[model samples]
Target chain A: MSVLLVLLIVFGIGIVGFFIGRQRASARETGEVKVHSRAYYHGWWVFLVSVLPAVLFIVLWSAGSSIYLERSAQASLPAQTAESAVASRGLALSMVRGIATGLDRLDAQELQNLPQSYADLRSLLGSKGVALASEGQDYMVPIAERWHSQAATARTIGAGLAIALAVAGVIFGLSGIHPRARARNNVERIVLWGLLAASTIAILTTVGIIFSMLFQTINFFSVVSPWNFFFGTVWDPRFADAGSGGSQGQFGLIPLLAGTLYIAFVAMLFAVPVGLFAAIYMAEYATPKVRATVKPLLEILAGIPTIVYGFFALVTVGPFLRDLSAAISGGGGFIMAQSVLTAGLVMGIMLIPFVSSLSDDIITAVPRAMRDGSLGLGATRSETIKRVILPAALPGIVGALLLTASRAIGETMIVVLAAGVAARLTVNPFEAMTTITVKIVNQLTGDLEFNSPQTLVAFALGITLFFLTLAMNIFALYIVRKYREQYE
Target chain B: MNLMTERSLEKAVGDKMNAVASTNKMKGDKVSVFYGAKQALFDVDLDIPEKMVTALIGPSGCGKSTFLRSLNRMNDTIEGCRVTGQITLDGEDIYDPKIDVVELRARVGMVFQKPNPFPKSIYENVAYGPRIHGLAKSRHELDEIVESSLRRASLFEEVKDRLHDAGTGLSGGQQQRLCIARAIAVSPEVILMDEPCSALDPIATAKVEELIDELRQNYTIVIVTHSMQQAARVSQKTAMFHLGNLVEVGETEMMFTTPKEKRTQDYITGRFG
Candidate 1:
């Protein structure tokens, strides 16, 4: 429902309640019988009181209720269907778990045991009803079966409570905007706090992400010293004991960090000049009609999802780059599908709009008077723009470039797909590389052992990425503020 | 005549007459102006003499400033403003396509009502025109031009030591003098002052008036002022414009003491400015 419509309804109710309350009090205050407040204030106060709780409840319910409903609907299936479904689902779960544990991969019989074991479990669970009826048992079942039944019951109840709680939230939210509401003032306060909170959220989230990584990194450092992670040349993060049964890992992070920076730098080199020039043309040279058509078209580039860009990089840019590198290098050892250049070019395409839109705004904000003043001195239009307007807007443009740099550094998907998983610290754009984010995804996707060096290294990489972006943002903001002060 | 009809008639006539008159040995003539659909100057006729200060004194909305702007073609920059009548400098049509506006503006310089010295050092402000127009070939020549211009404006004594300070950092009177110095640096034949001392105090006004007398020996000056006393004190020729028409034009002493038109007399006597 529209927020305005909701407020109007609440206001109507509040007005009616206010008159009723005022009428009750008026007889006591004034013998001749008058309303307690100016009719509007009374109406406003009543609306203010009821609407807040109603709105809060509605918002909470909207966000949280649907998940509970899906579970509840699952739980309330018919008894026969439930028994059959649970048996089949249990069979499926065991199969998944068996594959996950690598148990089924051991031998032919072990793999073949997957189907047999599932059938046995299914028959065992499904036969419980017959056994209970035939044995004439009222409530005495085996402890294991009883425990399972209790668990199922508890799941159902939990699902119902979640649904009800969500519904209750909706009711409370709607009630907030009702006639006796104090919500106008409450909402105003919330909006003010919300704006402050939103600004804080960016900083807080950065800190939270960094800390999450730091804690895990600390765990990694406990096993391998910090010095090895920071400076060791080799990054063989798979150190398996020869006599032992499982995975091996080594924890050198320098190669990965170098690869990340190299790829990011290459991407910026591709993006910055093209984006800045495009921004200058759009802001200063283009007519309004052309700008209106082109600006949104540029923004559309930004609107495309990163995942889509990643796919494009993989399917299109990768092969094209590989062929081009082969042609350029005369087929020596320059395979280019998993190269820094491929990732940089794709990432540059992703960043073009980010840089252009920001710099365009900064350039456009340059005052018209500066241009006029120069032109008045008989300077040509281009000369005026070059000497006066560009110089004045330079600091702001630098800030915009810094923001784009931060975005480029933090980007993950394009780098992941086009820039392959070979993490070699090479300056050559034709060489394959990996970034911190791609490594983090690889480390955490499987049945991750939290304390293992491989898993813990992901966290350390995340911390480094977070700090770099945070520093970029803070410095960019400082430069932009200082530039504004100069003009003002 | 009423203001509206006078403007409407001027708009109908156009700027060709002013152009022809200018080329035929008149300094400035027949200038008509329009701001969008509303006309401000009629096909007005006037001759501002060489090497003498000409005072244009009239009631508000009498097209005095409009006519003043036409002398230098400053009205060309105002959006939706159209000038139909011609104006000339030294028997050359200023509005002619062949005339370069930049060169014309340098030849016929103007100082506005407000003291608009650029936000720069006083020396730089004075040097702006000379540097841009390539009037001074070297640093020594530029320095000489700047010193002479400031001396001519009578601002050299007060600001000689602080030539590097921002012009805007000076007091209002000093800034006005600085602007005058800046205008004179280009060494134009005609100098247009639009209520130059209206923003200055009495002492500054007297100083500027004295400087105007001194400037008359070398340049033709046209001053637009509201003050009758200042007009009487500074000008040799006075042109009284009323309702966009030139009511009377003659020697300043003769026009003031014995105006031929009743409107001119009424205005000069301070009945209705």
Candidate 2:
């Protein structure tokens, strides 16, 4: 009567139906009458027909039955308990379900000699390894008994219906197999639908994430004004206790936005020239043997997890810069150990592979004819690349740089570790600063009430960061598309 | 027997207007070319006459293009390609270590089979060579060089109004002429063309052919052509190749009429390629 057992039975029916359908289709292949599809196509078609509906029914039934049992158990609660706050009601229902499972373990004699009080019942369930919460009440005993019986009955009826559907599917599927059944087409259609469903699931999940963040952001805005949150330069979100009349404090976006853009700009400054030179060398100058070995090594730099890069920045590069500055300045270093410079340098290293890989592909895509034309005109290789190849590939390279910029902006771990969390709006690269992603992590980590502005602010930060990256990606795609049309 | 007599009669008529022999501008001595492990061109000797259009005619993959590319050392760009014999420009070994390839290419320019104008403005495309070589001292001089180069390529009058338009925006034949202008801007003594009219329509082909005839007065031109008729029409001297070997070399009229080799006869008369 369990879901697993029902699934196994459905699979068995499908296997049987497969053989029967294939045999029938093969028998129809006489001299005058031909089977339209291969025998295995008919077999697979029948197997899908017999299995799909039954599996769907089992999944739907289990979900529906659990909801029905919870509702019935809640209704059976005592009037005082039933009329409690929604949170307490939910707590009571969970206790009921747990007691129901514990009751199933009791023998027949123990069931007949049931406890009459909550304390005694708790002791009996405790002996059965089902530790009920201290909030358990006497009325839960009867409800648990009724809940257990209803679940059992629901499972029995679900198993019967699923088996009956599988049998009917087998009969109907085998009946369709004849001299001219287009089983191959039907099977292919089913596969197409399966692929579409997979893609739809991914799209739906993205939409769901957006909507969930949007609603919570709306909740956060109700507590804090949009104008103050957006335009205020300060970003001191004072964490207030629930139900206390304390200042909500500033939730300014400017410092974090500046930090994000400034760090990304610094990373681009370091990465663009180096990465572009590497790309050009690989595309135009490197021999085939060198290129074959070097490109993958560059990509392997991209494969290193961002968290490892964060550790490197925190432990190695930040201190090295601080010491180097101290040595040169002959005093306490102007650069902070955990500063925007540290994070930007490390993040630039992380972004180098991204820029180089995309740019290498873009630069190589410049037609060989372009190089020949320039070289034939007596231009040196560097001169040819400077005037002809680079100009043709400029749009694509810009698109790649924009994509890398978005990645640098959204980077979290490195900023959190290397760039200190104090959200300062300083222009100096030596000072510690924070970005939106780092702030989002900061706001959400500690123990707090979900509805508090402190917690809700995380959702607001998340949506803002999402939109910023989204805009950059859209612009990048636009440039890439415009570049593509130039060649074709 | 009748075809032989007819060829003999045509040869007698061609002998009346025999071409005057000219000094050799570029000479290939026992030239051989290889791509990786594959030998593309066998040892061959051919001379390109100064200020004359010498056409190389052959079937596809018969090393005609290979020999043409070798004339400008363009094969050096291809990976694993090797040229074993000496190619000299006015008795100077082009492949010598002392010679700068950039300088040699400046003096001996090339045009590809397909029109490959730089993705730049037409004026920029023409000025690119002159600017790189420092042929002009000032902007005015650069402008004058561009105008004269385009004029020599026969593209000046047509593209005079839109000198700043993208060179790639021009039609195929115009693009090829722009490439020719780009080559001529450097004022190379020798120009190599690799099937320059293969990508053009008949009208464009005629225009390029006419331009080639005019260009022969100042520049030594070596052209590789698949069309026997194109070779006969544009070239003063013609060399026939088959299977990576030179079959015959003589006046274009005599080579087309009374070919010395049977393979040359078969290729030109459409017996088999």
Candidate 3:
């Protein structure tokens, strides 16, 4: 919040300075003008001179004062508290953390005990002076008392300097903004820079996130070889020492990867045709009456929460599929409670509107004359639609499908709740399976181990998932470009 | 005159002199057009002819295009555009329960003001009709049909070699010719041209006018035009529509030279439309 305030103040100062400087400059430019430059330029010059130096001073002083305050506070500590070097350093660090986070809550008893502990430690370490100070202690008492007061004084002075800089900036800024002011242009430049800064911050944040993941994944890769992590057959995240333990644990990603692909493939199989057909029906075949009624009904599917889909998969589709599978196979357990089929089916339903809406927009964008050209030639309506409309809208539809795939790949909560914990490498949709996201949750939810392969593997999987989606996005973009070129 | 042209002229002028008089000249008796409950054409009554290219000319917002569309029931495709009209193609009521719209459109083909060509080869553009209608049995038969249609449209000599290229790559006039060829490939009895030369240059307009004269030999043509000169050049019979009413209908030369109605004379003499 203070950072924002500082920027706002600086901007105001710059604007004010511009106007004052412009007025001065304006007067100078014209023979009738008393000053050497435009009035607004003169105002800007004065504003820059007045505010910039003070802002710079405040920034330097505040940064320097923090370190100075901390060091002074430490140095002001009595010989009793410093006798034990490690203890004193730990206390100092804790004190700083407390100030920063507001987390340190020392009760009256604790505070009392701290001074006594320091005194005892001082005596034990053969330190001489016996000094204990309270917040109420006067400045004339001793070095410790004076130190505390000075620290408080420094904070107050730093705050006052900040306020003074801000006030000076505001006054100069207002004084500069007159009738002949160039303050608006100065404001515009500041706004442009502010936008640049904001975008840079967003980019820097993304880079920071990526590097943070990369470092942890590098740690994970050191513990588990990259080849084994990428291509091993089994997926057992648990690691047991073979020398001490009765049985060794397995760790392989093939099952998870296979499960994810199978689930997503099933989802796409259900989603693409249904969604695209819906889009086609809406865009081409349906009358206005039917379209008006049906379009919103279909779009309403997009608004339903994915969590609701998860519940539906768990409670409704799971049982339905189980019964259907049993009827077909003459057995009940062929359809597990948390089977890929249930999750895939529900996810497909959830994704229908996303695909349909996007594809509908693209399909509708196709010129009506394309259909007319075919229809005018005595082609049946269906024939025209199949040959002309579908072919023209194919690229956009494919792009929508790829985007749906990316959504399915990154889907976390639905799969976590509905997809089973078991990871199996199989094509049978009835079988239970896990995905990368589910495994990441399982590994990282509890007490985190920075060095453990189990925990670090989550970051590795995250990076892999990121790349997968990145590839999908690029492919979608390529298709969109290709489709645009066809029309253009 | 050819066998078809002579028969059509005799049937149009002789059989329908005062066919139904004031009410029956245009046999669109039960016409009712709806654009989502906003009726654009209301029970329209008019007479269309056999051999002549009847020009349906009117000011803007007069439902001229709507009435023109109802001739072949083209309004059927527009959503919520319900029509209840007894439109006939050569005395056979087109809006009958049994008449197929697909066949009706093929029988009464249309050309829009804008030259809309398919993003396909010029050959494909001409061949699309015969291929769908199965007018030709072999590639050779199809090729001959395409050539004749293009020739009839007066575009064969210019575009014969480049028929393999996209139809849309042609110039505006050439594209319109390509569209005409496409329309002619099906060999419809009546060709409806909705201001065909509106998007063409003067030279292209002359070429299209010359083609229209040649095509008048076989096909009964209905044209909608904003230009009176275009109507005078191409049309044999003229129908003047205003505010969704048939203001006048007469032979083109008589209508231009000596109109009976004051509005018609005023319109011809460059007065307010």
Q: Give the winner by TM-score.
A: 2
Q: lDDT of each prediction vs. the true structure?
A: 0.69, 0.89, 0.73
Cα lDDT for residue A459, model 3? Answer: 93
Residue pairs whose backbone atoms clash in candidate 2: none
In candidate 2, clashing pairs total 0
Tens digit of per-residue lDDT, candidate 2, span B131-194 = 9999999999999999999999999999999999988889999999999999999999999999
Off by over 4 Å in 2: A15-36, A82-87, A101-129, A240-243, A483-485, B1-19
lDDT of 1 at B139: 100
For A267-298, candidate 1 gives per-residue lDDT tens digits of 88988888888888898778777899999999
Candidate 3's C-alpha runs over 4 A off are A1-95, A99-204, A241-252, A485-488, B1-39, B42-44, B82-85, B138-140, B156-165
TM-score of chain B of each: 0.90, 0.93, 0.87
Interface RMSD of each: 4.4, 1.5, 2.1
Top-DockQ structure, candidate number: 2
Q: Residue A474 CA error for candidate 2 (Å)?
A: 0.7
Fnat of each prediction, in sequence: 0.02, 0.67, 0.42
